[model samples]
Target: MNQLELLKKFTIIVADTSEINSICKYKPQDATTNPSLILKAVELKENRKFLNKAVEYAKKNGGSKKNQLTNASDKILVDLGIEILKYIPGYISSEVDARLSFNTEECILKAKKIIQMYEEQGISRKRVLIKLAATWECIKAAEELKKDNIFCNLTLLFSFAQARACAESNVFLISPFVGRIYDWYVSKNLISTFSYNEDPGVTSVCKIYNFYKKHNYKTIIMGASFRNIQQILLLSGCDRLTISPVLLKELELNNTVFNRKLIPPTIFLEPPRPLTEDEFRWEHNQDEMAVQKLSEGIRNFGKDQLLLEQIISKLI
Candidate 1:
């Protein structure tokens, strides 16, 4: 078997793009999307149909300009998710508006809205994972969302504190960005190249994995945003790894032998006392890399979201 098939024995592979063709070709167990991916996908000629449908949904709803645009923007996500669900049997991760990342109430509302859109289309809420940024407010928001049976995938997760907080909240999953963290270190000229064990991104996820396994935390750790095939190979036994189509193709072509590196510990320890909001903030802030990346990630996603809205507005 090729690496992709072998890796599947341990980790659940997820397609990280909004492109339907790639999802069909690679056949990942699950799929994830963000505004940047949706923006790129919507621009493609083949995906123009989804845009038209979203625009019509907004117009038929008959709201103010702002309300219509909001509805249209959300419609695009639901439309894409609904389509992806046809190809993959597992859950689809649709992220909330990045602009609402820091607003707990807004985050919760947006999450519910996404869920409602999916459910209205005859898709069960069980097939959807409402994604949110790993901000303190969003984490707190996720805690409440769980009561309504809304599972969340916390992105922009770089610090261990965020992982701890997510576990405490008992979120369904957490997507730690492996590539983004590696990119930060590279930009600083920290290291040009290194072995898998020395890679900061791999180490971060491993640390989180061990923590969860040792303490018997139920939250899933899906290693995402990989930079290379080696990063994916190193995280062979992660709960899930979201890969781009290009890398999936590479994995399919390569017959490299790799071992499962992550295994659950036999003995479980009592989880530590949950961290207070102040502690999570302080610990997360102390990691310069995490602080900068989380801010930049939110800003980048926000920009793409505005651009997506603009594209949908033109159609309306």
Candidate 2:
């Protein structure tokens, strides 16, 4: 089997794009979008109509631009998300604001608001996975949202500790960043970072993947933020992976053989022990890498969100 086929055994491939057509081409089981992807889509000449309609909806439902509409950006964001979902067969992960990552109540409220908007558009809760940062507050919100039967995709994950906490919480999915991890290693080592399979980011994901498989945790592991094909191949057996279009096209062109590298049955020998909020906190505090990555991920997402807001301002 080709590498993609091999990866499919243990991984559910997810496209990371706002272009519904691009996602259709790869036949990924699911798809993911963020403010950055949506921003990129709005800039594309072909998606102008999508952007325009969202703006129109905002005007009608969001009131005037001078008097900001509560959750207006989220409304538009979800509208665009619904459009993207039309082309895929699986769930779409829509993220909450990075700024709200620290507020459990606010996160829950925003999540409910988004889910309501989706329902208004005839989208079922099952088809939507609310994405949130893997902070303590976000986890708390996720737990509450779960009780309401709303699934969640815990994102900005960088450490085994973060993965452990997410698993303990029984989140629907956890997106462990692969590319950002690679970036860290290279930034720290410069040119030497180009070495073959020794990428630290790839190793990090493997560790987390094995941990999840060993414990047989229900929380699905979805690796995200890939930098190159090498990282993707290294994580062929991960539960799911969100790949950018650029990388997706590269995989199609190469047609490399993919095989399941992670066998949970082979690796996990102990019973699963879930972590508590305090246990998660202590573990995260000890994981310097997770702390650094979580902070960096938030900052990066926050900057992109600001840029997206600026773009929306110009459009309106």
In terms of TM-score, the best-performing candidate is: 1
Model 1, residue 242: displacement in angstroms? 0.7
lDDT of each: 0.93, 0.80
Minimal lDDT window, size 10, model 1: 189-198
Off by over 4 Å in 1: none
Question: Model 1 clash tally?
Answer: 0
TM-score of every model? 0.98, 0.90
Candidate 1 structure quality by residue, lDDT tens digits, 1-316: 9999999999999999888889999999999999899899899998899889988999999889899999999999999999999999999999999999989999999999999999999999989999999999999998899999998999999999999999998988999999999988889989777666788999999999999999999999999989899998989899999999999999999997989988888999999999999999999999999999999999999999999988888878
lDDT of 2 by residue, 156-260 (tens): 888777887777788889888888877776666643737646777788878887777777778888889988888888877778889988988777777666565
Q: Specify the highest-lDDT model's number.
A: 1
What are the C-alpha RMSDs, in order, of all predicted structures? Answer: 0.9, 2.5
Off by over 4 Å in 2: 62-70, 190-196, 266-278, 314-316
